[model samples]
Structure formats: structure tokens, C-alpha cells
Target: MSGTAELAIDAAFAARLFDELAARTGDAPGITRAAYGEGEQIAHDMMIREAQALGLTHRIDPAGNLYLTYEGRDPALKPWVVGSHLDSVPHGGNFDGAAGVIAGLCAVRALIEAGLRPRRSITVMAIRAEESNWFPLSYLGSRAALGLLPAESLSTPRSDTGLSLRAHMSRLGLDPARVGVGQVHLDPAELHGFIELHIEQGPVLEAAQVPVGFVTGIAGSFRYRAARILGEWGHSGAVPRGHRHDAVFALADLITALDRLWGEVLEGGESATITFGEIGTDPALHGFSKVPGEAGFCLDVRSPSPACLERIHAGLLHIVAGIEAARGVRFNLGARSGSAPARLDEALRARLAAVAEGCGAGFTELASGAGHDTAVFANAGVPAALVFLRNQNGSHNPDEAMEMADFAVGADILARLLARDDND
Candidate 1:
């Protein structure tokens, strides 16, 4: 087969692998490849098998990240890493994390078939535990691999299994002691660059009729994981209009105020989003006859602009204070998890754009509202960027969909990008 034909065949094979992995891990609901669990481990083994089939060497880092290496002319030079995570949220769609890794695999295969050697090694990495659904944490693998995770977080227990992250890693034969100690971390200075290919997980690309998008930046976000409001319980029917302090009412008022604040922020020519995903009243303390005495809720606010996030957060604080006084309730909101926005490396972005144009593919520039492993690497001082393939039905569900043609286009771009020399 000609080199171009061989590359095309590999790209098709990568797309098929997505179907096989998804079928193996999940069925009716969606993908259930939880981090350090049986399903995820199965997926990782498949990745390693594919790497070996392609004549690449594979190894697992201390944080449980998998790296498949293609040797270059100079072994000592830093590697150009291309990959994404293999784990998924419960019932999440197949393409969320797996597409990038598959694309990297195809890209490396294409380079090998063409018999091209660059100055630095090329590695296809399968990062671990990127979804926050299972562990109440995002970027678990990438952060630990970069030594950016807080040392104390290793022993923190998870909500689902009551097992700390360290325990989970130990169960999987990864040493927790090596995490954050520079022993398991990928040094920033030792990386030539990083690129990740992913499904858009939103409507932007599909709406624009574009096959791919060059990400300008990833949004920063703040989470109020365990926010509580306290008020005195009272008889629901007997209390006068001004006599009772209802925690549920207070929470309603706060939500309304935040909605209005969101509009104000949008009017100010900045992009931002806020979500109150979970809320509830204490089950044991309340009934239909009594006013709710305590309420708990979670909040998530995101923006590509740091200034916009600050402004929206300030508005939230002001709204909380007003609601507390007006409704006679106490508010206790604490920080849970957050990371700042990450801008893509400009030089690498230009190369991706050029490759897309050369392939005669339609493209656009956009900002990713959802966070990805690329942002983590970018924030850690590695030159990083992301390419988003058009996807529909959003993500984190069984209905998520993307065209195989789009996937092939993205894989081609990645192949061309990886094969290019810096001076070329």
C-alpha cells in the first residue's frame, strides 16, 4: 500500500477501536470505565496491546499513566507527547477521553509507515482518571504526573467507595509515595510539546458546520462542593409571613439572585456560565408539615476570562450576603476544586491550523467551555494545545455522537503535525 493509503487505513482502525472499547466497557447506559477499576484497566491493557502491535515500547508511570513511545534519532531529547485520558464518568460516552489516545496511536502509526524520524521521541500517552464523577477530582492522572497535585490529597477518601486515592493506586500496583515526589512526575523541561485531540462535547462545531476547531483556551472554573444554609425549623402552616426563617426559601432566593447576576455579567461583554447542579433538604429533619431547617447545594461557575470569573464570583458573594440577611439564614460556602484558564501555545496552534487548511478541511477558532487534560499540561508550563472534533448531543451520556469522517480528518491533522520538523 502507498503511504497515504496506509495512514488512511490506520485512521479507520482507530475509529473502530472506539466501538470495540465502548462495547467492552459499557452496554445500554454508556461507558463505565471508572479510574483504577476493572473496566478502565481493561481499556488500558488494550491500549498497551495496540502499542506493542505497532512496534512501540510501553510503560506505566507511578501515577498510573500509560506511555507508548516511538524512538527518535536522539533518545536524550524530550518527547512530543500526544494523548488524553482513558477513564470516563459513569455512563459517559465513549469518545470523551478515548478519541485522543486513538488519534495519537493512528498518528504514530502513520509516521512509522512513512519511515520518518524527527529530532525528539513521540509518545502516545493514556492519562488516568480525568473525569471527576468517580473520585470528586478531575485531572487526577495528569496532575499527579506533573507533580501539581497537593501532597495531602493522596490520602483523601472518595465519596463512592470510601477508599482514598492512595488506596486505589496501591490496589492497582502504583506506588502512592512516588506521586508528587518528582519520582513519578513528567518534568516540564523534558517535554518538547503536548497536543490532545477530543470531541467538542458541545454544539459549537456542529452548529457552524465545521469538522474541527482549534481551541483558543480552556475555561477556568470554581466549585462550591458542599455549600450549606441554616435556618430555624418552624410549622409550615402556622408561621406568619415574617416569623419563619426557611432555609429552602433562602436557597431559592440565592439561586434567583445568581441567575440575575449571570445576565449582568453577560451584558458586560464577557462569557460566563453558572450551574446549581445539586440541591436538597435534610431528609431526617423535615416533613411536609414543617419548614425545611437546613439545605445543601452545589455550585459551579466557569469562564474563559479570569476577570469575568472574578466578577461573577464577586457578584455571588454579594448575593449570598443579601440573602442571608433578608431571609434570616446562615450561609457557609467553601471552596472544593478549581483551576485557572489555560491558553494554547500560539506556535503549535498555527501549525495545526496550517495542517487543517492543507487537508482542505473547514475549521474555526473556539474556546473550550469544559476542561481537558491539555489544560492541565498547559498550566504546568508545557507547550500544549487541543483539537476538537465536532460532536453532537453534548457528552457524558450514551447518546453522544460524532462522524467517523470527522474523526478521520482529525487523525490526519494529528499525523501531519507529528511528522513535521520544527524548521519545516
Candidate 2:
């Protein structure tokens, strides 16, 4: 096939893969491909087959990360790795990780079809357990790859669910003892670069009438769990409103204030988001006697800029201080997840931007507010950049959608980028 014909064919295959996984949304919510679930394995199987068909060798690391390598003409240069993760949030969109995986596969296919091997090796990864809702360790695959995970992590118990992560490793017929096997040793400048193509997962691309976006930086995240204040539990009529500390009542006030802070953060010229996701209280507030004990809620904040994040952090401290004084209640706060801001490899980003323009695709630049495996690599000092495909209206929701044509366009851009010289 001609060069143009080959690019078109591989791009079409990527689009088909998106449709195949996206159509699996059963009902009521977004994707449920939590770590090591059936859905996750299905996605992995398809990717393996696709890689095998294209004549690439595949290996599943002890961490469930799938690496597919295609030999290049030159054996001396470090491999050029292109990929993203495959696991999704509880109800995440299909294009988030799957699109990146298929796009890399397509890019390699396009290159091979053109019969042009690179000056370096090409490795494609479909990392596992990035969502981390079920597992305590987020970025499970990348951590294993970089040897960033501690030995204690392997022995950490899973949630109430029967699937312990180490058990999952064993089921795959791999030894958990080999969990951090290949990651320990690495050359600082070893990898030419790592690139990820993912859905924008926000409305920016579609709103701007663009097809692709580049990541200039990635946001830092702060996940906090805070306890609420509660007054004594008594008969509804027995105690006066002023006398009760009602933990839920106090929590309700904080929730509303934080909700309002979200809008304020957006107006301050920073891409920031806050989610007050989970809440719990003591005693059954429903049925018979209203048992009242302690009530707590989780809060998460994200911002693409480090300076902006610090501002938000300061504002949060102010809010917490005020609550402590006015309510006479201690504001218990602790972080469950937090990561410093990450900047993309500028040279790598320039390369992709040039390729996007060459493909004649409308493009825009953006900072990723969502965390991913790419962010993890950058954290580990591996130079990395991201290409974000346009996300339809919804992303983490079950109704998440994106145009197939956009996927095809993104594949073309990735192929062009991979076909370029890294050290150039």
C-alpha cells in the first residue's frame, strides 16, 4: 500500500478498537474496568492480539503492565516508548487510556507498513491499575516498571473484595516475588522519550473547535479526608438548634463553601477542580434513633500550575482556620493522595505539535488536570509529553463519548511523531 493508504488503514483500526470497548457500557454509569477486572483483561487481550498480528513481541510485567516491542533498524539507540494506561475510573470514558494504547499500536503499524524502521527501538505499553480506586497504589504498572514501589506494597492487603493484587499477579502465572523485577536499573538518558496520546477528558478541545491538544504541564492533586463537628444526639424536639453541634449540619456548611470555592478557583486564571466525593457519618441517620458520632468527607483539588495550586492551598488553609474558630470544632484533615506538579518534556512536545500540524489536524495546547501513567514517568525523571484527543461532553461519566474521526486524526499525528528522529 502507498504511505497515505497505510496511515489510513491503521487509523481505521484504532477507531474500530475505540468503538469495540466503548460499546460495552452496560447501564447507569461509566466504565467499570477497575484493576484486574474482567473488563481490564478483555482490553489487555485485544491489545496483545493486535500487537501480535503486527509482529511485535509482548511481555506482561509482574505489575500487569503490558509492553510490546517492535525492533528497529538500529540496535544501539534506546527504545522510543509510546503508550498510556488502559484501566479507567469507575465510570470513565473509553478513549482515555484505550485510545492511547490503540493509537500507539496504529502508529507502529503505520511505520512498519511504510517499511521504515526507526534509528531506535519502539516499545508500546498498556499499563495496568492507573485508576487506583480499588488498589492502594495508583500508577501500579509504572511504579513496578521504575522500581518505585516498595516491597511492603506487594504485601499490602486488598480491599474487602476478594482480589488481592498479589493474588492477581499469581493468577496471571507470574511470581509476586518478581513484582519489581525489571525496573531497578536504568540509564538516566536511556529512553529516547516516552509519549502518551489520551482523550482530553474535558470540554476544552470541543469547545475550541479543535481535534487535538498538547500537554504543557500536568496538575498537582491533593486528596484530603476531614472530620466534621457534631453536637449531642438527642430527641429532635428536646434540644434547641443553637445547642446542637450536628456533625452533618456542620459538614453541610463546609460542603457548600467548598462547592463555591470551585467556581472561584476557575475565575482566578488557573485550571482547578475540586470534588467532595465521599461522605460518612456515625449511627443510622435514618431508621429509628438517630445515632450521631463522627462525620467525615473527602475533598480533592487539582491545578495544572504549581503556583496556582499553592494559592488554592493557602485559601484552603484560610477556610479551615475560619471553620475551626467559628464552630469550636477541630477540623481534622489528612491527605490520602498528593503529587507535585509535573512539566512535560518541552522538546518532545514540540515534536508532536509539528507532527499534528503536518497531519492537517486542528490542534490546541493544554495542561492535563487529570493524572495518568505519563505523569508518573515524568515524576520519575523520564522525559515525557502527552497528546490529548478531543473528549466529547462527558469524560469520567458513563455517557463519555468522542468522535471516531478524531481518533483517526490523532493516530495520524502519533504516527508522524514516531516516524521522526528523536535526537533531531
Candidate 3:
């Protein structure tokens, strides 16, 4: 609505898109939607529609990533790609990934409506699985696009559920090998820059009274699912003190040990967190599964830097192994998901900051506390930047939002960044 300055965005379109996104989130029939479900497809369709309405060329990657391209002055240039994921964590807010996608769409709207054309083409992509429950890790689609996708991901199992990613892809008519790494020509601009507009998904910016932010770099994640203990379940009241194996009790011991090591990690000020985030017992018994069976649970050991995570992982695994041995619990440690820390494009960051200043959008430099698809480009050697909007504390919940005015400012900044030759 601000008729485009050097760079501007359509606040009205962004708000409309956000509302539409909320509508699409539950358009399909289910309480929870995983990566390849019908719900995700519906979500993908809504994004495609927005792109079509904008008159941008549209396509979906073999991995189900949706891209809406806006032609620049030179139609031949590899476009400056923007936008984020459309998937959400189980009950996540509609705005987390959705806002960024809309922001990208609005970027183009602002540019075209402002009656400006650039040397580089522009694209808004709604990548898949950034919040995937099926992949068991983040950034699957973008990694594939950047050629960093693991060869083994196709056969990788999601938890103990028998579904393999390969099978899911097959069902969706996608061959996993070619998913994120498809036919887009990485033109001059693409070689140098990539920008993503996303909600802050945390309380910091809004609480600080800032309307926008220039991200320093996104933090990395290092985690291995810990099957730290395996114990036999027995009759609760009948099991003798030393003669029986109470698997839950041993798991409790392991959890406490993990807590202590986590305390040490917190004390180091390295932005580390070790969460026993999820768990599964032998049976979901009403009151009795008294067969004296097995017990298990998961552990999430994560940190922003790969180095710090590695150190913490090594020490914690050692301590956990020790706990397993000492507490009469058996251990079956599972494999770890490999992670790379992303250091954002500095030149892009500076340009974005300048854009924020020009737009009069108060902003702060910060780090992304969550995993994002932008890291895929960083891991694959592309210059990438993230623009974060404000959200209060409710990530992975139903109440996420980006203030209309704040989102508009961030969009303007993103447009400027995209329009600049700002990559180093």
C-alpha cells in the first residue's frame, strides 16, 4: 500500500495472505498433518494459488517445494530467491513459515506495483519439511535443492514408525534423489545471494519494541536420538527392591543424569539445550502392562554451534553410558543426524539492515533460535540471509502472529535487500 520506495511491500496482501494461510492450515481433515499428508498438499495448493494470483510462473519441485517466479528486467538471470516453509510443527501457529512465504509474494507485488524492474529475476519458494515430523530432521527440501541432501534420507526411518521417507516420496510421485536439486539455473544473482523472510517465532523482538530484525546467522543443531536406557518392566508393587528391573525407574535415573550435565552446559553460556523432548514406553497401558517388558525414551542434545554440540554430545553420551551401567539399565544408542552451522551472508545482512533503517523499521541484529531452510543454502555454499518478524512466546503452538505493521516493515526491508547487489 505504500506505493513502493527504492523497495517496498504490500502490507494489505501480506495480511490477506496470512489470513488465507490460517484458513488453509485446517482445510484438510485431521488434527495433525505430517510432511507428505493431504493437509500439506492443501497447504501447498494455497501457496500456489497466491503465486498464480500474482501472475508469477509456478512450479513444485520433486520434493514438493513450491516456487513462484517473478520475472525481472532480464528474464534470463537466475532469480534472487526468497520465502520460507509452509509446513508447521504439530499445532504450530499459521504465521511461522506462512508469513515468510507471503512476505516474498508481497515483495514482488511491491516491486511490480512500484513500477520498477531489476537486472535479476525474483522467486518466492514455499519449501517443504522445515518442520517435518517425518524426516526426523529439518531442511529436507532446501537441502535437496542445494545438493546437500543426504543420499540415505530416502531410506531413513522416522522414529520407530515403519514409514521411510523414500516410500512417502514414492507415494507422492516424487523421486527423492532429485527432490531439492532440480532444474533451476543458478544465475549470477543466485550465485551471490538468497534471502528469506520469516517470523521471529520468539518473544524477543516484540518484547524489545523492535518492529524488524536483521539476522546475524542462524544457529545450527546437533542432536542424536538417545535410546539411553533399556530396562525390563515388572509388576509395580510385586517387584522386589533388588530382584526386579523397573525400566521406568532406570529411565528416570537417566533423565536426572542428563539434567545434571545439561546444567553444566547451561553454565558454559554456549546457548546449549539438552532436552528429553519426546518419549515412548513399552505399552500405552490403561493401568497394567505387567508382562515385565521393555522401556525406552528419546533425548534431544542440541546447541547452536556444531563444535559445542559435539563436545556436549561426547561428554553427555559418556555420562549416559555410565548411568546406564551403574543403574542396572541397558543402553542402545541410536544414530545421530549430522548438522552444519550456518554463518549468514554478511553483506546481505548489512544491506537488509540499511533497508530497515531506510524504511524506519526499528530493528536489532540477532540469531535465529530455530532450524530453518535458509541453512540449506548456507551449507551448500550460497550466500543467504534471514529477516525475522516479531512473535511472542508461542512457537509450535496455535497462537503465533506477526504484527501487521511490523510484517510490512520487514517486507519492505526484504524487497530492498533482494533488489540490491548486496552479496559479498
Find the candidate with the highest lDDT and give its number.
1
Specify the highest-TM-score model's number.
Answer: 1
Which lDDT values do the candidates have, in the order given?
0.86, 0.74, 0.70
| Candidate 3 lDDT tens digits, 74-149 | 7765667888877766666777777788888887877777776666888888887777566776687776665556
lDDT of 2 by residue, 1-424 (tens): 1244345435567767776776663324656676777678888988898898989999887677888988877868787788887877776667668888888898888888888676678889898877766676667777777777767667655454656777777776666777644455333368877889888878899899998898898888877744455444555656666665465666666777776777887776558888877887754453244534357787778887777667777777787777656654566675456667789899888877887777677888988888877887787778898888887765767666767778778878777766665553
Model 1 misplacement above 4 A? 1-6, 180-184
Residue 21, candidate 3: C-alpha displacement in angstroms: 2.5
Model 2 compared with the native: what TM-score?
A: 0.88
- Per residue, candidate 1 scores C-alpha lDDT tens digits across 1-424 of 1243344426568767887897899856888898888778988999999999989999898889999999988788888999998887787898888999998898888778777666678999999988876776768889888877777778777667889989999999998888846464588878989999999988999999999999999998888888999998999899986988899999999998899888988898788899999999988888999988899999999999988888888888898889888989999997568778999898889988997897899999999999998998898888998999999888888887988889889989888776665622
Ranking of predictions according to lDDT: 1, 2, 3
Clashes of 2: 8
